[model samples]
Every structure is written in structure tokens, then in C-alpha cells.
Target: MLTIIDKYILKKYLTTFGVMLGLFAPIGIVIDVSEKINKMIENKIPVVDILIYYYHFTIYFTNLLFPIFLFLSVIWFTSKLANDTEIIAILSSGISFTRFLRPFIIGASIVSIIILLMGFFIVPKSSEGFNNFRYTYLRGDGKQAMRGESTDVFRQISNDEFIYVNSFDVASKTAYNFTYEKFTKDKLAYKISASRIQWNPKTKRYTLYDYVKRTVGGLDDKIEKLDKKEAKFNFDLEDLTPVVYIAETLSLVKLNRFIEKEKKRGSSNVNVYLVVLYKKYSIPVSAFILTIIAVSVSSMKRRGGMGLSLAIGIAVAFSFVFFDKIFGTLAEKSSFPPLLAVWFPNIIFGILAIILLRNAKE
Candidate 1:
């Protein structure tokens, strides 16, 4: 149960967090606005629209960094108490350090929950609209979004098939320098080469131009020339496009569906998508872990006041970001489990929080 003092501290912590995020976010965007000023002007983004742009930016900007601030907020609030001799006074009143933590935990827990919601559910959805708005309106003439529908560097329609192309133009929905391979019975059965492959949207089939087909069996070889008007190949946008964060843009259900489709097709390099899926859920729980870390580090009164706490909070937060990237790189390039890569940083920090909480109380 939280006593009156506990409630007071909790309120203070939350208040500080809100104020800091509230102020810092706009300042950050203002900085962004300045950086993009030339492009914004060139794109003719109106002043009013600029405000709307900032509004959208804040949703993602704040969400992107809320966990960091929440952790720092804990440190700031706790350290303020310590630096003010309030912590000593509370301890002197026979309130054990452990007992005093109840309120901080409670406060941090609430913050964590809020942050988690923003990270998984709210932020991803908002980011798409925000990014689209910027690229369409604020990015100006030098930039053009990937408008073409055709894609390359993907698993082909046939099982054990693969294709790689330098670029695909959306205007014609065609790919160039296309090579398609087919493997059967664990043997390379055939190879197809086309200078260009196009999508006839009206027909819902692909057409390859100036193509050659070759087949090899044991010592037998055959070659055929293609002068056909169109060649039919079934591939969806999701199948051929270089899997970027497109999977991430989808909701949990949609993301899972994509994962299943890609798996059934025997596409490797689905690790990035899997990472995004797990992170959607895992990131929310981190709100809890980060809160614990913050309260443990910051909720004490020290001579340096909130500044010291803030620094420590930032250090821990950055460590999480750094390790997550490092592990992600390892997962993509090396043979590490994608799930483990995304979650390892969180796990490490969570353990540290537990240890810190124990040490803080003692």
C-alpha cells in the first residue's frame, strides 16, 4: 500500500516526466523543422501544414523515445529527493529504503504501461501516415517515393525458385536483367533469362520480353527461344519486393499472415520480419523493465540532484539501443535466432534492473 508520502513522490515523478517530454519533443521537432526547412519550402508545404506535420511528428517522436525519458524521469525525481536530503529524512523516520520503493514502482509501472501501448500499437500506425505526409508534401523535388509496383530480389512463384534484378520500374510494372531459376529433386532443372519482365495488371499475369529458356537433365540439354507476347508468372508485391519494414507497417494479424506466406514459399531472410513481430509485443513489456531500472537508479537523494540521475538514465537507455542494434546486425549477417537478437537487450536490461532494485533497497 502506498502511504501519503509514496503518493506524493509518485505524483512528482509523473509530473516531471510529462513536463520534460512535453517540452523536449517540440524542441526536437523544431530542430527537425529547421533541418528540413529548405525542402519544406521547396515542396510548398504551407505554414499551417507544417504545424500539422509537427503534430504528427510528435506522436512518433515522443513514442520513439518515451521509454528513455520515463527511465530518466525516475532518476530525476528520485535523485532530487536524495539531493534535497528528503531521502535521508524519510529513512530517518524508520522507513526502510525497500518500503519507500513501493510508490516509485507503482509510478514507474504506470509509465511503462503507457509507453508500451505507444510503442507497439500506436506508433507504427501513426508513423506511416506521418512519413507519407512528409515524403509527399515536405520532402520537395529532389525526392521521389518508390512509386513503382514491380519488385525484384525475391523468391519466385515456383518452389525452389529465386530471382534478382537491379531495379523494377512501377510505371510499367517491369523488372530488368531478370534471371529465374528452378530447382527440382534437389537439382538445378532449368534457368530462364529475360531482359525485361512486366506485369499486365489487367490480365493479372507477368510478361517476359526477349527471354531464353534452358533446361538440363543428366547429360541432356535443351534451349528454346522466346518470342511470345507474354509469359505468365504469379508474384504478388509482398513476394518480390526487398523485405524492408513493409512487414512492420502491417498490424499483428497481417504481419503474421505475411510471415506464413513467406515461410510456405521457402523464403529465407524472414528474420527481420520476425524481429518486428516479436518486438511489437516485447517493446510494451519493456515499459515495466525500464521503469524498474529508472526507479532503482534515480529514486535516491544524492548531492548532484536530478542531473546525475538523468545522466545515469540516459546511459542505461542508450545501452539498450546500442545492444539491440548490435544483436540485430548479428542476427541478419550471422546465424543467430532473430527472436533472441531483438529480445536480448531487453533481457539484459531487465536483469540489471532486478539487481539494481535489490541493491537500492539494501
Candidate 2:
């Protein structure tokens, strides 16, 4: 059950989204090029490479701007419709305000779906290549390895070995209260405990200080407690990536896979990842919510013209984004679930939409 006027509103909003992209995407690229030209000159880089790098970076920014576009697009389009008395015409024609919402929801739903899929599955795959290429060509070498947080006591590198360290000191390359487990054939084969563990990045190995080990070979397990020890093992670091598994670095799917791996290793830094996953879904849903909110807020064209509607739209959108980031960071620090962290902004705005629409209908 669809009406022609509803489709008209949806089309108007989508058209606005496209026009905004066309206007802003190039501006983003130009601004980026202007800022980065000096860096390119300092590095003695070529024009082509610089262009490619900026283009890759543009993808990141474009993704960031998408939600903003969604808000403004809906606001601008709906405000125009109201100003022209088209909405009044529809209402007088026996169409309820709620009925007018159907097409806008459908349009926003489509766009939001595309954004979620791209964020989670598509963009991250491309980002891997773009980022690696940048690191190899644009960035400096001698990149420092990652550091671990004190909150997480256990570390996992792969399937076979799991380690527990009391405290890890980044500068000293040492860990206190170190315990190691090596599994083979789905059974624990060796267990080592150390008072201190030191890492040698050159060799990619760890040397355990004041070590004791137990080897489970036969029915009788032989335990050897060493006063001090050295061993070549891969349990040298903790966390998925200090710089590697960063939000900016991951799109969506890669982020999920990374969180899963870290959880398996008994790591506790997944709050950020979980929030990001929720955000990937929530942001797209915002397209639908914002569409309804815009229609409610702007479709009447009061003393405030399109300029006022646009300003309100921008302010509301900015507030949502700011609160979303702050809450997500807080969730990362606290025990807030990632899904809640990600969707909190959308939930607040959706409620706002319901209230606004109820008022508008009156």
C-alpha cells in the first residue's frame, strides 16, 4: 500500500543526499590536498602518489560524513515540500501525517542498510590495502610495537599457547608474575611460571626470569621449578593492536573478527570493538530516524525558514555525534555492552522523533 506523494518525498530526500555528496566530497578532497601538499613536498613525493593517498583518505572522511548528509538531506527536502504547501495539500486530501512517513522510512532504510553492509564488510577490506600501502610508502619506518593494558591479565597469540602476566612494563620490556601454557593435541603439554619475562623484538622471543615449569607427558606429570629461566616463545606482547586494531583502522567485519580473536585469548579491551559494531548498525538506522525527525521538525515551515531548519538539523546532528563518541568511550572504559554503547545515540534520537511527530501531527 503505497501512495505517489510518499514516493515523491522519498525521492526528494535521496536527491538531496546525492547533491550534498557531489558538493562536499570534492571540497573534502581539495582541503585534504591543500593540507597535505607540504608533507608531500617534504617527503619528495610524486603528484600521482599524493593524489592516490588523499583519495584513499577521502574514503575514510566520506564514510564519516554520510550520516550528516542523511540528516541535512531529509531536512532540506522536507522543508521545501512544506514551504510550497505540498504537505498541506496531502493532508487536506485525507492523508494522515503517519501515512506520509512510509516512503521516507523506506528510503532511509535502504540507505542505512547499504551503509551498515559497507562499514562491516566492504570498506574494511579496501582499507587494509590502502593503509598498508600508506604505511609502506608514506609513513616512516621503525614503527614501535604495541603496549598492553594492566586490566587484562591473560594474553592469547594463537590457538596453542596462552599466557598470564601480572603486570607488563612497556619501557623495560618485562612482565611480572608470568604464567605460560602450551597445548598440543587438545591437551596441555607444558606450563611455565615466571616472576619476570623479558621480550627481544629482534628475535621475536621471550626470556622468563625466575621460571618454574610442569611437563605433562605420561600418567605421572613431572614438574620442574627453576630458580631462573630463558625460553624462546611467542608470548611477547598483549592486545590485538595498540595502533593496529584502532577504530579508524578497521571498517566493520575486520573489527568483529579481531574482537572474537581477542575474546578467545581472554582479553578485556573489547568494549571499544563491541561499541563500534553496534554503531555500524545504529548509524544506518539513524537515516530512518532522522528522516522522520526532519519531516516532523521542518515539514510545517513556521517563522523559521529553510535556514532555521538547516541550523536546527546541523545542531541536533552534531550533538548526537558528540554524545555518541563520548558515551562509546565511556563504555570502553566501563562495563557497558558494545551494542548499548553504539545504539544509545540512535535510541535517544528515535524517542525524540516519536515525540516530535506526535506534536507535529497536532
Candidate 3:
């Protein structure tokens, strides 16, 4: 049994959300196009391709900024309602403030479901195109495809296996100063060192330059040397070194498997992937929390009307973004846990929402 007030408020909430997207998305596309237009022209990129890129850009930017839009939209319409005395009339009609919040929660739930679906299924595919266009035409080709924290990578591939590479060249499919070592039961079993290693896509094998292999026995070590050799190792090219956007291009299932595999490999950059994983889950939950905060704050009719409410909304929105970035950076650079970093913003604001909601209720 949907009351008139519930229907009215729900319509307003969802309408404002859609209108916010309509208002900001084109502005974003325009600014993005302006910035990239010169590069597109210089690179002789086709108009159709550029337009397609903006289509993906629209999706990417809209998803990236959806929470901000949602927060602002809730504040806008609710403040308008407060100004018009609609909330006062409704409350005077014997409706509890908690009951009044039902439609907003319902609206938030709807938006959260949409966003969760987009983040998991659509964003990954669109991000691939958006990033490919940036790297290929916006940035120059021949640069290292992957941008790990360090060019010189060292990792434990297993309990007794370790690998090292000084640098990798994505253009040439080659690694410099490559080494792999294997140990068994606390004894060195074998070690392989090479001046360079190149991947052959067709043959699916590695060509090692100036390769040296040392096989250790109980009391003695046997060494073998070769100028060049084709070898098959336990890892693939993506396993040894993946591009920065690799995680962004994977679906939820693949991303989890990737993180687990990286954890097993003792990769130093696993935190980065974990951050992405946590954010997908966090964003949806934040939607509901932010809706509560927005509705509670804006439902009051302040002396300055919609202007004051919007000012407060903007401040809170920026604070959310700031907290998100600060903690995300801390997680990546320091020992801060990725899960904590992703959820900390939601936790802090959720507490704030509770306090505000209590005050609003009283």
C-alpha cells in the first residue's frame, strides 16, 4: 500500500537523480573532448572513433562521479520540499520522520543495484576501451605497458621458487637481467640467470639470451651456458608482468582470482588490486548511507533555504571524496590495509549519518 506521500517523494528522489546525470554528463564529455581534441587531431584519429571514445567516457565519468551526483540530487530536491512546506505538512499529518525516510531508502536501494551491476559488468569493458584509447593515442606508443610501483620487480613465485627482472619492455616483449631460482627442503636445487628474455607469441616460449643454468647436487654444482635458448617456464607473460589496467579490465570473478593468484605469488602490488575489489563493494553500500545523510540534513527548512542546504551538501561531498583519496593513497603507499582504506570513508560518514539522523528524528 503506497501512500501518496511515498509515491511523491519516491518520484522526486529518482527524478532528481536522473536529472543530475543528464546535467553533468554532457559537461563532462565536453570538457574531456576539449582536452583531448588537440591530441586526436595531431594523431589523425577518426571522428567516429573519437565519438565512440566519448560514449565510453560518458559511462566511465558518470559511474566515477555517480555518488557525488546522488548526494547533491537528494539534497536539492529535499531542500526544495522543505522550502515549499511539503515536509511540514506531511509531518503535521502524523507521519513519523523515520517513516518519511522510507521512500528515500527505497530510491537508494534501486540506484545501488543499478550501480553495482554497472561496476561489475559494464565498467570493466568500457574501461578497457577508454584506457586503450588513452594509452595508444593520448599517450605515445612504445612506452612500458605496465606501470607497477617499481620497474625492477622481485617476487616469490612459490615456497621454493623466486624470480627477478630488472626491467620489462612491452614493445619488444623482453625483460632484462632476468633470474629464476628454485630451492627444495632448504637446499638450493637450481638457478637460472639470463641477460635478457623475450616472449614469442607464436611459439608460446621464451628466448633467453646469454643464459646460464646451475644445478646443485648434495656436494657439487653443475653449470650449463648457452648464447640463446628457447625455454618453457611455469608462468605466462601476464603472470610474470601484467599491465596496470589489467585489474580494471577483469570482471568481479576474474579480479578475485587475479588477487588470489597474486597473493600466492607474493606480489608486492596486490594491495592495488585489493583496493579495486573493495571499492566495487563499498560504493554500493555508500549509496544507501549517503542517501540517509543527505535526506536527514536537507529535510530541515533552514533560514537560507536551498542555498544553505546546497552549501552544506557540497562541503560534505568534497569531504567524502577527500577521505576516499587520502585513505586509498595510504593503502597503496604504506602498510595500511586495503579493505580498511576502502571502507573507512563509509564507516566515518556512516557514523556521521547516524548522529545526524538522530538529531533529525528528535
Candidate 4:
């Protein structure tokens, strides 16, 4: 069912895309190493760890810029075809422009599937490793940074239990002015307060200083006080000290579950998580849009040659990234809808692709 032309174009498409990735990957690694080398030396980071970190970084970097890479590769190869008069000959052979696009669509489908699979399973693991490495070895205040804000933390640990802390120390795993409240049928059943609470990892327990417990009754209140108390709670320090990039570190299934949990907990950063979740699908869908745009723009022979086409392709690619970043920031920082932010760039570029294709056909 496949023609020689289709096979030829598909081979060029895949090989060019792979070559583009190969070319950019080393550049990215070199830039990253240059920035992080001093930190690595200062921390005496293991060479094995550094190598592993870059391995994950490559996946994270590639996935982040996959559309741009695909777009450029398509433009590069198609422009070559146009320059060599291959496209003109193919069009002259009575193959409709739409028919000529079949292999391109097929190539896009293959890339999209690979990107989708990576987004679902592979990229999450790589993201976790990449971020963890940066925070653990590269940042001076890594734990505090990873844990986000250090003060005024609140969380609902369960349906009936809520916890609050005025401030937390990531280095010591300590919470100051800690309060734990339990409600039964929306009425306060009991409350625990501590001047200071520290997590003892060795014991897997909490030591609360100046601890007090209050019990509510129909007619009176019972209060117990202690200089120090050691006990277990339903939640751990991780519950209070959520990493800023926690959502990015989860696989698709886990990310969905995390979003639901964050929603129940009334997390303020839920929009950031939603943006990440929406982009997993949006980025893959961009493969098709960018492929079509690339073909449309470069399939026609122009006096400007491949260099001109590449310049245009780079501009368009950067513009796409710019739009994506702007909308993503708006969604993360403001009340803009995350789903719309994720798809708006694709929608705009999809329209452009259609218009360009029509012009090329004409």
C-alpha cells in the first residue's frame, strides 16, 4: 500500500528529525554542564550521579522542545526537496497536494505517538531525576526552595482533620506554632497545639514541645498539657513540605490522582499542576500542527532557498514557544484557565497551518 515516494519522504522525515535531536542535544548538555559545573565541583558530586543527571536532563530537554525540533526538521528537509525541484516533479506527476501530504501526516502520527508515550510514562521519571539533581546538588538552599514557602502552611490531611503551621524549617524538619484540628460533623471534636514540632526520621515520629490537647464536650472543655510529647500523626513532613515541582514528577495516572488530592486540599498551586497535566496532551497534538505548517511553508520552490526557509522556520518556532510561555505564565500566575492556556498556541498555529496549506495548494 506504500509508494516509493511515500517511503522516501517518510525516511527523510524520521532521519532528519533524529538528526535534529542529535545536533541539539549535545549543545544543550554542554550549556547545562557549563552552568552547573562549578556547583558540582563545590559539592563534590559523584561523576556517576552527574552522568545520570544528564541522562535524565536529555529526556527532559528534548520533551520540552520536541515540537520546535520537529518543526525545524520538517522545514529543513522539505525546503531541500523544494530547492532540488523534487516537490515540483512530484506535483507534476498528477499526485494531488493532499495526496502528497499522506506521508507527512503519517510521520507526524508516529512522532505524536512517541511523544505522547514519553509524556505519559518516561518524561515524568526523567523530570523527577532532573529536578531532584538540580535541587540536591546545585542549589544552596535546595530544601527550602524545593519545599516552596516556609511560612503559613495549611493542609487538610483527611476529611475530618486539618493542620496548620506558622513556619517550617526544611533543614530541621521542624514546624513552629503547629496546630492540628479534628472536626466531627463540621463541629470541632478536638484540637492539638504545639509551640514546636520536629519530625524524627529515625523513629518515624513527631516530638512536640509545649504540647496541649483540647477536647470539646456538650457542657465543658477538657484540656491536657505537656512539656513534650512524642506521637505519630496521619501525615508526614512531606505532606507539609511539598516540592514545587511535585506535579511534574508524577506519571499520568499519578498526576491525575495528585490533582484530585490537591483540589480537595484547596492548594493554591493547583493551576500550575493543571497546566502541567494539560500540556502532556497539548504538546503531542502540536506535532501534527507544526508538521503541516512546516510542509506548507517549505514545499514551494522559492528564490530565497533553504536558508530563507530555515530563517522563517526558526522565527515561527520561537513565536510558538513565546505564545506557549506567555499563556502558561498567565494560567500559573493568574486566574486564566489552564486548559485554554495549554491549547491556545496550538489553536493559533493550527489556523496558520490551514491558511498556509491553502495558499501552497493554490
The TM-scores of all predictions, comma-separated, are: 0.72, 0.71, 0.79, 0.82
TM-score of 4: 0.82
Better of 2 and 4 by lDDT: 4
Q: State model 3's lDDT.
A: 0.85
lDDT of 4 by residue, 118-138 (tens): 999999889878876765566
The alpha-carbon deviation from the true structure for residue 74 of candidate 1, after best TM-score superposition, in angstroms, is 1.0
Tell me model 4's lDDT, rounded to 2 decimals.
0.88
> What's the ranking of the predictions by TM-score, best on top?
4, 3, 1, 2
lDDT of 1 by residue, 52-125 (tens): 66776888788767667677766776777777888889888999877877776687677767755665566666
Q: What's each prediction's clash count?
A: 7, 1, 0, 0
Best by lDDT: 4
Specify the poorest-scoring 10-residue window by lDDT in model 1. Answer: 142-151
98-191 per-residue lDDT for model 3 (tens digits): 9999999999999999999998999987876676567555664323323212356677778888888876654366777899999899878999
Models sorted by lDDT, best on top:
4, 3, 2, 1
Candidate 2: tens digits of C-alpha lDDT, residues 34-81:
865664566565677666666666666667777777888888888888
Q: What is the lDDT of every predicted structure here?
A: 0.72, 0.72, 0.85, 0.88
Name the lDDT value of residue 51 in candidate 3: 82
User: What TM-score would candidate 3 get against the native?
Assistant: 0.79
Residue range with the least summed lDDT across 10 consecutive positions in model 4: 141-150
Q: What is the Cα-based lDDT of residue 266 in candidate 4?
A: 79
